[model samples]
Target: MQPLDAMSVFEKVSVADIPARSARRSKTTPLREAISALLPEEAFYVPYFDQETGEGFKPSTVAQVVGRMSKDSADYRYSVRSEASKNGCYIICNPKPSNG
Candidate 1:
């Protein structure tokens, strides 16, 4: 598939382009199948990847690719789409920030 560089950062990522396994609807799947609906409702901490580790913050394109390229599986990787209440507050990746 081609890269989605044409999409802007503020664009709403569509599900049609994203694969079913990679695209998860919180309220659709079975009760036992809802990982996002687990014990805590902290979707903010949706956990794209561990920040402490050296892993980089994945771009929306990569996430879309993941969504369009795979099925939900034991090893299926995914990115919890940002639910930022404020628009234009996209997550920063490089040179981590601190609370101080």
Candidate 2:
């Protein structure tokens, strides 16, 4: 869905944002890792693109991968949302830093 207003904000996360597993750590999905590498918005929305790799991912594939994680995933302290744009479907990851 499209963002209802212009005030909505998001941040792209990175592999660095994700913590390493503990001796009893939880599992991480491929989707979760990818979402972490997205771009976060400061004043405005920035589209998803991997600068280090000089490549991008299909929004649809992103959405599906993240969706799977939501069903059976660890608490990564970030949330994923999909939005519609003139270009196509895009994904956003909102940071929710956790202390655990």
Candidate 3:
């Protein structure tokens, strides 16, 4: 048997030959607005990172937003679990029940 040619296995098509589709709108809500709407008993997941790392942890925006909000409020209570794949963590926010 002869050796297989890698390029010969696949067919190449021109970019212009591809079908055109309409642009889809983004479904993303503003971060602050979304965070502000969280129910007291609701738990949300956010990615986290370590500031001090000769290891391999980068800063996460979700983590920062949650942290800032927690610092700004006395009633905010949260639990975090290390879930997901490598270098990822989940911040589960469990805020205290409001008086009202």
Question: Model 1, stretches more than 4 Å misplaced?
Answer: 1-56, 61-79, 85-100
Where is model 3 more than 4 Å wrong at Cα?
Answer: 1-29, 45-59, 79-82, 85-91, 96-100
Enumerate residue pairs that collide in model 3: none
Q: Which tens-of-lDDT digit does each residue in 1-100 have in candidate 1?
A: 6579975578678889876686665422332233323332222222333367633333453344435432342333333446445221122122223336
**TM-score of each predicted structure versus truth:** 0.19, 0.30, 0.39
Displacement of the residue 24 alpha carbon in candidate 3, Å: 23
Best-fitting candidate, scored by lDDT: 3
Question: 4-95, model 2: which lDDT tens digit per residue?
Answer: 78656777799899888766422334345555565444112324445686544465555556666444534432343434453334444444
For each candidate, the alpha-carbon lDDT, in order, equals 0.37, 0.48, 0.57
Q: Which prediction has more favorable TM-score, 1 or 3?
A: 3
Candidates sorted by lDDT, best first: 3, 2, 1
RMSD of 1: 17.9
